[model samples]
Target: MYVRTSEVRGDPARLDEGLRLIREEIYPAVTAMDGCAGMSVLFDRNICRVVATTSWRSEDAMWASTETVRALRESAERALGGTGGSEVHQWEVAVAHHDHPVPDGAHARLTWMSCKPALIDRAVDLFRMVALPQIQEFDGFCGTTLMVDRGAGRIVGTAAVESRGAIESSRDAAAMIRERFSTELDATVDGVEEMEVAFAHLHVPEMV
Candidate 1:
């Protein structure tokens, strides 16, 4: 599976308006496109940051939607009163596992890591064997997805939980495991964040 994420930092006051536009306009449009598997949004009110992610069944489908996506993204930013320029990234869904569909009140903890390009495979293997199991053991754990930019040696891991409390409860343990895994994988932790899963509607593609 392939994923595209567009990140924008904007005013907190306009967040609701942005979300509304996304649901009413962007979501339906993207999902209707060929090979579109799913779409999601992540928001951090405190930081006034929002990220919109779309999953595609194939690379070609993802690339084909670029023009439409560009226009929709511009509309979203305008509605949101977004300030800074957006950052867009493409990734391969290296690992995906779900115990259940993401719930209404789900929250996610995200970690961004950087490592040597040649060690990307090693990082994925370590995550599947060690990190994933540990994460599943946490209370209220719903699912986990690891996205990778192999050429850039970038890995973004998202772990979903039932609520904010669940995210907090698992922090200490999660951090310990993250630290150990980073060491073994020779990865440097760039940033770790927790945010509300503002919207999540992803269909697991057969290919994934």
Candidate 2:
């Protein structure tokens, strides 16, 4: 798996518009291309920063996909460059270590779900009480954890799953859970987006 991380900044008024374009135009083009495994996007309106990522089966496959997206790349370069706050980097998936083994032939989906600050506690609770049980039983289900930005009072749900199919299916599963938990755990869940990515392991060299 390979990681392509892009950092971007745009005018406040155009934030939502830019994100929409990336989701609808840029990402779909990349993900539908050959060799593309998975992808994820994250944005913070307060800070006007965005992080977009995607994974590929191999470095070759990644390049193959990008090679065909020349126009898109050029447009992004023009729109993103010289904005005084934009960058993109590519990295190899080097190493992965985990207390629990990932599912066979499985991939990871990193989602930065954001909702109203008032809904944070219940949102977390909803996942813990309702979402987890259902999601844990998914065939390709891996696991999930939350990263709460205390200062911002925003929550980030970072999840790892087996495949794109699993991520999509989880929605129905979550809906069922929501049906049960909505009364007690209803939240203004503005968005629950998904991104698939290859996980890379990073480790230090050992003594010879």
Candidate 3:
């Protein structure tokens, strides 16, 4: 599977409006497009960031719909009162797993990292084999997704849980796992943010 992420950092006060547009406008429009497999949105009020992700069945399918999504993406940024356009990225879905169907009111922690290009595959292996099992064992665990940009050596991962409190309690342990991964994989942890899973409608099959 492939994925595209459209991110906007905007005014915190307009979160609700942004989310409304995402859930009502962008979701339906994008999901209806050719070859779309799934779509999800992540919102963090503290940083005023919203990330919209759409998964595709193939590389061609993902690129084919880019232009059409451009307009809707800009509209989302405008709704958020964002000054500029969205930060966009294309990725390959490296790993995807869920304990159960996602429930309402789930929260997620997103981790961004970059490593040596050659280590990308190794990193994915470590994550899927070692890190993922530990993650699933956490109380309130829901699901996780890992996406990679091979050319850029960049990776973005999501760990969804039942609520904010669950994320808070798992902070230290999560940090330990993250630090270990970076050390082993020679990757730099770029940014980490906790966000609300505004919406998730996935059709991408589980990889693990």
lDDT of candidates 1 onward, in order:
0.89, 0.53, 0.89
Over the stretch 180-208, how does candidate 1's per-residue lDDT look in tens digits? Answer: 98999888999998989988887654222
Better-scoring candidate (TM-score), 1 or 3:
3
Clash pairs of candidate 2?
Answer: 39-196, 95-201, 96-201
- Residue 15 error for model 2, in Å? 0.8
Output the TM-score of candidate 3.
0.97
How does residue 153 of candidate 1 score in lDDT? 98
Worst 10 residues of 3 by lDDT: 199-208
| Residue 108 C-alpha lDDT in model 2 | 47
Model 1 pairs in collision = none
Which lDDT tens digits does candidate 2 get at residues 109-183?
Answer: 343344556766666666566656655676566555444433344444444567768767767766565456444
Error of 2 at 168 (Å): 27
Q: What is the C-alpha RMSD of each candidate to the true structure, in Å?
A: 1.4, 12.4, 1.0
Show model 1 residue runs off by greater than 4 Å: 205-208
